[model samples]
Target: DQQVKQNSPSLSVQEGRISILNCDYTNSMFDYFLWYKKYPAEGPTFLISISSIKDKNEDGRFTVFLNKSAKHLSLHIVPSQPGDSAVYFCAASRGGGGSQGNLIFGKGTKLSVKP
Candidate 1:
């Protein structure tokens, strides 16, 4: 049973455009979140993260927002570049209460930024 779901499997955007990726979760107990970007032959790289205590987090061209009431989250990339093309995965975990913080991941949405 998948706890996280990325509704769209792919997204295409032109260079310098904005790319948005979405994800939904079944569990309401998840407290921590993360996003990872993966290239074809490389491992997923850490991108950005947010905690349930905060509604949003931003770094450079990447932004992540969490909607606790909806059990949903989204990643936004502005000024998209060709090098930004990758599979983006949304992940979450329970942060406290003696938990080890195991992350649940979405299938990922492949983003293609065309130049």
Candidate 2:
């Protein structure tokens, strides 16, 4: 089964702290990993992504680490701000070979940042 899983349903952190979200996958064929962030009543926005070929990818205050051998991935946000409060989804899919962008997303982890 091609399934993506986010073990934690939610997380809470104070401003200026670090927040981590974890995810797991069972499909060995997946080659691309992505993290999307969503706000209430809004669609998810692409945050960052890492190719299966790489171990890590970073963008601004966000970082993603992928462990292909372990079929696991994580998203880390540092100095979490009040604006960072939102739901985060972990997704995966097969690489560019005619593969439509139909992402398999986890239920999502809601991150709440306290001011």
Candidate 3:
């Protein structure tokens, strides 16, 4: 069963535009959330993250919003650049002391930033 899901398989955006990616989860135990960007034939690299306690978090052009009530989250990238085009994955982990923090990942959303 998929604990996390990305309903949109792909998203297309113009360079210098905003790219919004969405994710949903059924497990309430997830306390920590993260977004990862992946390139072809490579491992996913950490992008952004938000704790359940925060409604929103931002860094530079990347922003992550968490709505615990709805078990939903989204990633927003402002002024999306061509280099930003990649597959984005939504991941969650149950955080606690001594926890390995295994991440449960969504299928992923392929983002295309057109110039």
Better of 2 and 3 by TM-score: 3
Cα lDDT of model 1 overall? Answer: 0.94
Clash count for each candidate, listed in order shown: 0, 0, 0
Which digits, one per residue and each the tens of the lDDT, describe model 2 over residues 20-56?
9999999888888999999999999999999988999
**lDDT of each residue in 1-115, candidate 1, tens digit only:** 8999999999999999999999999888899999999999999999999989999999999999999999999999999999999999999998665554788899999999999
Off by over 4 Å in 1: 96-100
lDDT of each: 0.94, 0.92, 0.96
What ranges in model 3 sit over 4 Å off? 97-100
C-alpha RMSD of each candidate structure in angstroms: 1.4, 1.6, 1.4
lDDT of 3 by residue, 9-111 (tens): 9999999999999999999999999999999999999999999999999999999999999999999999899999999999999976565478999999999
What's model 2's TM-score? 0.93
lDDT of 3: 0.96
Clashing residue pairs in candidate 1 (N, C-alpha, C atoms within 3 angstroms): none
Model 1 TM-score on a 0 to 1 scale: 0.94
